[model samples]
Target chain A: MILKKLFSRRKEEYWWMTIAVPLVAILLALITGVIFIKATGRSPLKAYKLLFGSSGLFPSPYWKNHFAEMLLSSSMFISTGLAFSIAFKGGLFSIGAEGQFIVGGIVAAYFGYAEPFAGLPTILHLIIIFIMAMAAGGIWGAIAGWLKTKKGIHEVITTIMLNWIALYLIEDWLVTGPMKANISTGISGTPYISATAKLPNILPGTRLNISFIIIAAAVFFTWFLLYRTTIGFEIRAMGYTLVFGMEAPKASGVNVNRRIIQTMFISGAVASLGGSFIVLGILFQYPPVFEGGYGFDGIAVALIGQNEPVGIFLAGILIGALRTGATSVQLAHIPKTFPSIIEGLIVAFIALQELIRYLIMKLIVPKRSKSD
Target chain B: MDNTSLLNSSLTQTMDYAAPILFAALGGVMSENAGVFNIALEGIMRFAAFFGVWGAYISGTPWIGLLWGIGIGIVIGSLHAYITVKWAGDQIVSGVAINVMSMGIITYLLELIFKTTGYSPPVPYFGSSVNRIHIVFIENIPFLGAFSNLTILVWFAIILTVLMHFMLYRTVFGLRIRSVGENPYAAETLGINVVRIKWFAVIMGSIFAAFGGMALSLGTLSSFTNAMANGKGFIGLAAMIFGKWTPFGAMAASLLFASAQVIQLLLQVAASGFAKLIPLGFYLALPYILTIGALIGVVGRAVPPAADGEPYKKE
Candidate 1:
């Protein structure tokens, strides 16, 4: 009964609660953000107006270009959010997605930039790079899974450690030592991938590319896999049941260990796709200090989305828009990290769902009793 | 320099580096021993470091800065305790939220206060040359004398480790905390206030973690840099695990990890041919790699408190 209360939906809950809860959380976060802006002696209204104006939510002359940039950013978030959600469904916290993402990008860049693959057709080249990236990420994630089962190591610790190791290895060794571009230039980054390996832009004169469609398809595939298939059922079962204890699943003869490894491999592969998008669609070459903190941001996305694929898609866009908009807050002398504070506040509020629910219950119960 | 002197110098560096990790790991032990999984150690330390610098810069005193840092830690700890203990929130999620929030809030505050994105200006630092104690007798000794000249924080960290070992194993409050962590229901039945104990444990742990941050901003450097805590908070968690969740064990584990870091630094400075043969990344990643290895090897032997991550409920 206690477990059910913890995991299962409350019977008295209304459908609007889902939408209302997140809406309330976002509203509160924005209010808190406004207070912060005011405390810093900035005009909160101007800051927010600039934020919305730049993000293209409000009518603006350059809204189209900003919207495209938002889409590009959201694509990575969507992919990484799905990656985290997949492992989360299987009762694993694969925080090492950042490492997997980095390794995957490195491998894809290697395959794309190598002279041996230059002669291949564009379609064939892209296919090979994607597969190799996923494969590398899968292997990376599988190590964490293997340690969990074989050595009883927790994925949290292993993944966190792996993240640092991956960062150092990529930054210090691979990019600088073995794979340094032949042409020494001002910037420290790999040579651009062959034109054939690049992701085609769907929109003319904008950053919008094939990644948008790919991320949309991934979202659909994740939803279909989790809610419409038997494997998904087993994975969800494993996640929820493991919370209570091992007796129920063990008695049912499920090979929990194998499932964990498989789930993590899939998780890592999905996260790798996010990195591939950045390399192929955005950067076209891996820079020495390429964008980071996206893997960590994905955790916030997954949590706000309630680990659901469709919800994650919306949350990803919301975060993407906020991040893109935050750049304009600097116009009002506010920091770009302003949106991050809002995002953090939302996550913190989400963590306090019980408190929110209790408050709502208190407000509703007295009214119902009076009516009775 | 001779090889022996080089080794001694490296060992001294190791002791210096170990102080911060040791403080943070001891904090982790305290909180985890009381059943709160404090992944927010990193965030807490970062927040404290920023506040430490801010306070010292404003007050022209490192002692005031240290107090300000601990005060912020206590506030954050209380907030975490209220959310997790009072509201029965998920511990890990709460921790992650705290970390995320700290990064954003600290960054925003940094820009607001310092008008810079990267780091703060130099501030009044704790343990200046005059205040730093150097034992003449110990300094005269050969290899083991490397620990003679040290910052006050290093000695404080050492003393706290021993103090914590006693606090966890010898006191009535310690027994209650252990009982609350192992089985809150039984502890409650025995008239122990699980909520109060957890609140005390978490707040105390946060204060200790603040000291770790102070060690970085005041003891080691006089300024706060963006993400200065780096991954030391996580390393402290690894140390807590590597030590089998014991205070002494965590301190020892921190020393081991710090030694790896010191060796890496020594390699860079010594300019040995062997150092050139190995990639810098290998040395940079050595401590984390060793941590993972230790966790895997010690899995069966080292165990956490029974109800580590679970939120306590009163029926």
Candidate 2:
């Protein structure tokens, strides 16, 4: 009877469950990570301490620069996380954020170095580059959307393929051929962007730049777009077809295909902004090799944030801290990839949330209520 | 070398490249045909590659290493099956999680065991145990000469392709798997053990994927490298789709992709001037571009199983 009751479905109207489940999942993941660390003959507590210390949570003078690094990293995550969140909310999976990011960065880099753009006013140059980057990313994303609408191809497959295409195209052709800088020395990557296009540093002696403000504005814009607009309502309706019924949207004459394309365009544009920030604010040029799985990391952030803009911002910061702290763990003779394992574990645990919810319900709801 | 010899060498290289992809694609066919989207093939293959090398290094036998790889594949497969089938979890999310976990765990193990992260030490080769057979007259043939010096895994992949074709099309068990995939409710109503069949198919597919990983690490390099699987599993998934989810069709697709890869390599080597004239990126991106084109071409007509990606619920 208890087993049957446990398996039975119950209404999940309580909002606390949403907050509690991810927290519990995170806790479980950390415990699992600790076990893995212990198995490696390392003190989990020390490793974690170092991780947080380097993340700038601790007021350690030795790791003074850690906070700046964490903020810088989180900026990219916040943008990409918003990118993923936007698409996910529209019921489209935009796995090509990685590709969009690359193209965005490369396009911005190209325009930043263009001779004509070099002489423009600083604000105009930055605006033009950002717009071009968004357009490039939007075009890339729109291709996947077009395929889904016209060809019935899954975005996941197309996006995955596009990522490799973007990587190879940049690495082999652009970086090695037309974009190659310092050709006499055979160095890879393009020339540095004009100083006018560069994002001004917000803090002296730190990498933090105006990109943080831009990202914060983007987050607010996304929230406004998703919640305070008619289009957003239609998109949400199309997304929650299971809840609202697919017929209602069709009956109301909301063009589903156009919505898919629009969502993907916005998704790609946001992700491209992340790439643009990386180039203008940090690298000042498109590098031959781009490290960090910003696109995939966005998926985790979006999921943990439950597709909320503010939530994604917080999740991005959390991930950024973990990534920054992981370097310290690496210095302590532990692999830097340990934080990724914890992230993966959290996702896995989240996947099992339904089971967890059932168990929780069983524990909390009285057995006497079985008659009801 | 003459043009014919060059062509022959390229064909041989294509076969070498195709073998691992063919194995993995066939695995994809098995799982997808049974209604499970095995997105964790990449992670499974990576884990197997590591274990294949580790087992050979420890046991001093390549065969044992192969077994170890398969064993690990089964474990991962069962976990995936349990999570998706029993728990009704999101397949893509779970698959991504597995991939992420595999990356971390494998890198951790690599550092812990070998004290290095780039590559593992070379392991024993299967060639030492099994002698190569030479058919001299046939080896002289122009294109066929490519088969002259090849690993046993290449032959295994080809033979398995044919065998899988028959097994999937002609077997009772295969019918049941298909039935479950197409309509689990109907299959269950007809007394078929849907969950059990799915578990079996997933496990079998994972084993095949592991062998593909082994072919990469053991068949060629005899060592494990980080990210050595290098999106071959995704390519295999692509091949599976391009093939319309058939064993023979997947083999043909794998061969086509392999040819594209070989042509790219040839461009880099034999025609450096031309390679430079046309950006190297175009060549590198050719196979994926072709796969995407193929997907676009076939999406409407090439229908997947009706129940594919849906979690089966028993009422």
Candidate 3:
């Protein structure tokens, strides 16, 4: 009877465990940070005070300026996160996000600066740039996806390789080709875009602009497509298992594999939009380093968010805060690398959260009686 | 048709350029055969390249530099083995972490030690002058003349290929290693120490991958750069996969990609009237594009080892 009762309780417990685990993990990280601070001879309390305390709190003028930078940072991350989330949900780990983002960014830079159609209206130019970026990123992503789907090429290998190709292509393009800037300096980047193509700021002094709004729309659309559509359902279903029989989606007359391809394509398109946003909204030029590691960070963001849209939005903000606050903490004498350390720990903790919980349950729960 | 001249020149460049990838791909084959997905080959190569060149700069000897490169690879590979194999961490994530961490470590170390971001300029480094092979008889032979003079390591790789072929396909230990890859559970039941084999494969793989990096830093470039391994690790992985995971096949695949790269370079040089139409951007992406294309083109499946990335546990 106790066993049955315990079993029944598990369902309820699990509902809470899902939320509790990630939250608890963050708490663990913060506590660990305390230990780190103590070891460094700084008061843990003082460090925390500076890291996320009242002065660093958002909405104030000082916080406002930093918050804008965070948005710019998270703007790229959110787009990449959405990209990872989309493909991951469809049972594909598109590790080529870095490559796709770079290709997209470089191509968009070309469009933004090198076109004879520079005299076009701002909105039209933006549309053209967005389309080109999306196409470039999509094509890059589709190569990996196509390789996986067609040749059984493990995407993990192909995507990583494609990243190198993307890097070289960008570097080579910037140095001696169509998009080369006319500077004598030994830097690899394109000429700056026409002013009209740049994202105008909402707050005038801040970097927060049309790109943030575009990313917001993309997130909303991703949520709608994933949860509220038949296509999403099919894609998610295919991801669950390949063994199809009586209970298969084919029984419901839906083609699951097709949905998988469609979803990845959409994922690529969304990620590409992020590349466009970065170029059009902020950077205004394609520097090799501008690709950064946003796509890589996106994977961590998606995981921590548990692949939910609202969760992603909140997680994006949390990550934004870390990116923002890490600098503040550094300015206050804490190590600047702490944020990355925390980020790494959070990802590790979450990825292994299930196993940890299972271990805990095994330890805490008593053995069943013979009668039960 | 003067096919001899083209073949002769292409052969020489392939040996020089393909050496790094050949070593790395061979290592990948061993690790994959032993059921460990060695995706951190890129990072391993980079770490080795950086440290290998640094050691040369500090120790004033290329041999010591090469050994240091190998040692660095062993440490990085062991960490990869411990985390992914022992802790059962996600292989992909761990591999990426190693890559990221190595990049930071190398960057920081470069700044602290060398006070530079990437390239350490060519110091007075020394390695075996196996840079040229003067096989007197072959040097006098008709079309085979130019092929005689190549790096000694090129010959070493060819011999190693045969040696590996015998070791992997002919020996009892090789059979056990293959069994471990096919099914660790069955191998364990049959009394093979699967964990030990995996560790052996990873460490051995690391040593070879390190040599690949050394080839870049010591053999080809005579210097080190940040992220110097570039995509050679991925190229090695591609070669491994494209070759269907066989040692010889993988070597051939590595050569194919390396040759594609050489061709791309040559095409850039000989950008004649018609060749000018091909954008340098597109041409540069040829090798990777072909890797993707090759993956799609091959109809017969290239299956990975059954337990390729899965950590074994005795349940």
Q: For all candidates listed, what's the TM-score of chain B alone? A: 0.94, 0.93, 0.90
TM-score of each: 0.94, 0.90, 0.80
The CA lDDT at A54 in model 1 is: 81
True contacts kept of each: 0.54, 0.57, 0.23
What would the per-residue lDDT of candidate 1 be over residues A225-282, giving only the tens digit for each residue?
8778877777887888765654566678878788788888888888888889899988
Model 2 docking tier (incorrect/acceptable/medium/high): medium
- Candidate 3 residue-wise lDDT at A248: 69
Clashing pairs in 3: none
Q: Using DockQ as the measure, which candidate wins?
A: 1
Residues A44-87 of candidate 3 have per-residue lDDT tens digits of 77666666642234555477666677776677778888888888
TM-score of 1: 0.94
Clashes of 3: 0
Best by lDDT: 1
Best by TM-score: 1
lDDT of 1 by residue, B62-151 (tens): 888989999998998897888889998877777778888888888888888898997999998865776576876776466767777788
